[model samples]
Target: MVLLLGIAAGLAYGLTAFAGAFLAVPLLVLFADVDYHRALPIALFALGICAAIAAGDAVRARQCDVQLSAWLMAGSLPTMLILGALAQRLSEPVLGTIFLIASLVFGPLLLLTLRAYANRMAPPPAALLDAPRRSFTDATTVVHRSTADKVGVLFAGVGCGALAALAAAPGALLGWRILERRLAGQPHLSVGTLALASAVLATLAAGWQFLFVADVPGYTAGLYVLGTTAGMGIARRAHKWLPQAPTHRALGCLVVIAALALWVVVVRGATAST
Candidate 1:
């Protein structure tokens, strides 16, 4: 059961670049009867490895933005360390409730955002086809960033790191949204930048878990690693051939599904306990 759950979680992590911890921790608690604390650390460790591999792929593809990644990680690393320590002291029920609330709130908002983006990308009526359009060069030109933009990026990074430490990946979801807004028309670069930052954050959080929070088993970690590697390979290949529209829509749906699953786990556990 543990191995099966690990693989399932790893596949989620690799394909979406999020949700491994979200899926793994709850499944571990419910099915394998592992405590939330122990489950989280193991999941974090596995996710760290998965993110590292994905980041490498992104860098090799020349889709990563090193300056953006560095600025994001500057705020994330210390925040992760602090929040990870705090997570160790929280009760399982408290953590579960937090996860439940986050899922409910963020899930619908994300779905709505995706729908809106899709609408924006849809073609206009034939009457408008003759209307003047911005030149390709003008449309793709990189925008200058203000101080507010830099601050927003840093804030998003801190938020992402904190959530990750607490066994959630919604922070990464939020980071992606922020990046997408800032780096419009460059989806690959925005995603790759986030991937690199996520790799660093996950690794630091996992190391903290190993040293202070829990002792993860080698076999369980191995299973997750294997599954994530396979999933990453599949996703990488698919990205080459698939259109961006459908891919974004699919990702939005997957986030909703994962969020609902998390809510069910926490709510059911709470009800059972009471």
Candidate 2:
């Protein structure tokens, strides 16, 4: 079952992986009895693999965005180090509660952010960035925006680090929602980059936690990796024929949100009981 789930998860990350780790963590911890202690690392490990695959795809698509990736890494790595160092001080319940609250709170904030982003004035179309925004194959299309808007690029990197540490959600999870707003009029990061970023961040985060925080049997983390991979596989099969029309996409998002909401409630209740 673990192996099966891990494969399913791998596919999910491979495809619309924006939220694979977020999608996988609760399920693995809640359903598979993979305690939070081990669950996060396992999810991260699988996410790492997912990131590598996405990176490959980005390279193929001529959108690798090497500069962006480097900047993102700069922001994410330090936080990862800080969070990993302190993960032990934070218990599973604390992390879970934080995850739950963050999800609950983020929805409204996201709405407001989206609205603000939408209302921004557009820059003249013909005016271009100093460099034509040239980047690798699998990168987001270059866009022109207010100088103030461009600076937030740093926020992407720093926030990714903090969020990945806090709740293991950096992909289409919170990051996607936020980016969707900021990049509304432009091509988003190549899906490949999004997926690979998830995998890489998750893997690194998981590795750090496993080495320093959790002391479970070695095999347990292996199960976590297996479980996430299987989950990705399942998600991949589900998305095989998924249409990306606006209607279909909206419906899909609602379904995932609903299911995740229910799962979260169930987990909270179970945790309270146990």
Candidate 3:
């Protein structure tokens, strides 16, 4: 049962960058009979491993931007550690409520953004559209970091870290939106950079959980790692063969489903407590 849960969680993580941690946490609680607090750390640890694998693949494919990832991490790592420590002190209900609220607020926005981008209807300026694509392998293709871009990265990092620490995979969706806005016309690079940044942030968050919160289950973690590795491999191969429009639509639907599940959990917890 534990192995099966891990595999299911991993498959969810492997399939979508935005919804993995979000999907994992609640699913862990519901399916694995884990408490919300325990589920959080487990999901974080599993997500870190999965993100690392995905990032490695992105790097190997020359799709990731190292400099961009570094800047995002600089802002995200410290914030994640601090918030993760704080999260340890919060009660399960409070954490669940927070996740529920975040899901409701951001879920629809994410869905809309995905649809807009998929349809090429996002209102990015023509100048951004004309900006040159940065090559992961070729430093010459890298553009100078503008002040605005740096600020955007910093803000996005803080938001990502805060969300990662609180509950669910807020970082992935937040990072995706930020990267998409800043790196217009370069969807592949945005996705690659988001993966790498998420990996780093999730790893740090997991480390904090291990050190301060509780000991993670080895069997579950190991199985989740295995599942994530396999899922990412499959996703990478299948992505090319799939159409973007349908994929984006599917992801949007997933965000909605996850959000609804979180809401139900929060409501049930409230009713039971009352």
Candidate 4:
């Protein structure tokens, strides 16, 4: 059961870091009956590992824009460390309320993810969503020409980190949205750099929670790390043959939904049963 849960969690995360962590925390806390307080840390850590691994390809592509990225990180790191700890101290109700607020603010992005997935299955006008973004990768380069743009990124990154430290549910769409306008002009940069940086920052931020903030069972973190890395490797290999391939895209979306449903049912049922 432990191994099975790890794979399921990792697989979901492998598909996309946010999707994985968004759903995984409830599974670990509510279903696995790990304390919710500790679960947040583990979830954050898990996301960090997965995002970093997947972003490796982007790092190799020279799209990271190190200077601007540094600014973003500088703004985010302290908040992640601080708010993440504060989050650990809150009661479940308080945490839920906070998450509710974030969900309201950033909930539309998940709709976008849902829409993209539904479209991949079959075009749906009712989807009310857009494409699954590469987060910060496709955006941000054009902003580099001006200091004001970099400062904007810094503030945005800080905000994302603060929210992410709280729950990470909003960071996906929020992070991507932060970059969308900036990315509109710089088509020359590969998605790799942005991908890798987001992956790394998230991983580090998440890892801090797992290692320092939570009480994850023995080897659970290792399992998350290994599973996500392997999943990323698989994705990279597959991408070589079918860049932006329809099948892979669809598969990613369906996998997320299926896994998320599993998590909800298992966790929610367990909660009600208890």
Candidate 5:
């Protein structure tokens, strides 16, 4: 069951950077009967591997900007560690509830964004949400020069880290969205850079949580990694022909379903205990 779950999760990760972790956490809680806290670290560990594979694919395809990814990680890693540790101190039920709320928020938002993009509508005008005003064409891609400001990149990283620490799954959606705007018309670059940055953050955060914050089930985590590895290989091969919009629609629906399922579990557990 865990292995199967990993494959599904990995496929999601490979196709769309946000869905792998988003799918894993709640599915683990629902099927494996794992606690929310433990599920978080386990999903994140496997997600790191998937992210690495995705990043490598992007690099090979010349879709990634390595330097930009580095700057994003510089601010994100430490923030994720600090906030994740703090989040660990919260009660199990509280943590689960937080993840549930985040899922509810991000799932529909993602779908909405997809709809807007599909129609060729403009995004919001906020500084963070707007497309970078200045861009220059390069041999490989169009570089959004204004988006590379060190301060802005760091701030975006910090925000992404906070979101990740709070709910590892939803954070990826927002992170992807932010990058999508900055790297407009460069879908692969946005996904690749975020994947690279997230891979480092997720791995370190998983390690820290395993050592100090939670007792990660080694057997379960190992199975997930194995499954994820296989699934990612398949995704890499089929990436060219994959229908991204349909895939994201499925993801949005599944995420909402998972969140509702998790809520039921939380409520049942609370009632039983009370």
Candidate 6:
């Protein structure tokens, strides 16, 4: 099960560049009987590794936006460190409640993000020469980015950090929505940039958790990491050949299912305790 959890988490990250932690934590809590706080660090560590793998592929493909990723990290890092420390003080039930709420909120939003990404058309070639508009090359495409987009991305990072630290889920669904709007034409670049940002933030937070909050089992972590590596390897090979529209819907359906499972866990835990 530990290995399977890792594979599932990694597969999700590799395919969508999001939700690795979200899927891991709930599955851990519900199936492995892991406490919310204890599961957080383990899930986050997996998320960090998963994101790193995806980001590396993206960077190698020249699909990443380094500038945007930097800004996102700048905004997310401080908040993650601070809130992560505070989270240790929260009761298991409270933390579980927070995670449940976050899952419910972001699950549907993930669908929306996917829909927006699918529906938006690529930028016209003339966009490359539009005067007074600043254009930059992301791999092979010329996309225009604005100052407002930068600020918005920063805020999105801050939001992701807060959610990651408090709820054990990176707010990548929110970040994706922002990227969908801001980087309309370039889906790979948007995914890559956000994956890079999420990788750094998750790893930093996991490191902090390891040092100050939790003692993760070496065996468990190893199993999860190994599983994630295998799952991502498969995704890397198959993602291009996969149909985009139905794939997005299927992934969205999985998110909704995970959210529903989380709801069950929270309610059962609360009932049992009472």
lDDT of all predictions: 0.63, 0.52, 0.67, 0.52, 0.69, 0.70
TM-scores, one per candidate:
0.77, 0.68, 0.83, 0.67, 0.84, 0.84
Which residue runs of candidate 5 sit more than 4 Å off their true CA positions? 119-148, 213-215
Badly placed stretches (over 4 Å) of model 6 are: 121-147
For residue 88, what is the lDDT in candidate 3?
80
Candidate 5 vs candidate 6: the lDDT winner is 6
Residues 1-274 of candidate 4 have per-residue lDDT tens digits of 4444555555544444234445555556545556556666666655556556545434444444556556667767888888877877776656655655554444345556545644232211101112234445444445425877777777877786877777653254445445544655432121223344455566666666665553466466456445545544454444334423243344345434544444455455457766
For model 6, residues 1-274, the per-residue Cα lDDT tens digits are: 9888778776766665444456777777777667777777878887887778767766666667777788788788889999898887787667767776777677676666556655662211111111122234535564467889889988988999998898666787777667767766776666777777877888889888777655567787788778877777766666666664565556656766776787677778778988
lDDT of 3: 0.67
Q: Residue 53 in model 5: shift from native, Å?
A: 0.3
Question: What TM-score does candidate 2 get on C-alpha atoms?
Answer: 0.68
Regions more than 4 Å wrong, model 1 = 17-21, 119-145, 238-274
Best-performing candidate as measured by lDDT? 6
Better of 2 and 6 by TM-score: 6
Deviation from native of the Cα of residue 120 in model 5, angstroms: 7.1
The better candidate by lDDT, 2 or 6, is 6
Predicted candidate 5, C-alpha RMSD: 5.8
Runs of candidate 4 with Cα error greater than 4 angstroms are: 14-18, 112-144, 168-170, 185-193, 210-215, 237-274
Task: For model 6, give the 10-residue run with minimal summed lDDT.
Answer: 122-131
Pick out the ten consecutive residues of candidate 4 with the lowest summed lDDT: 122-131
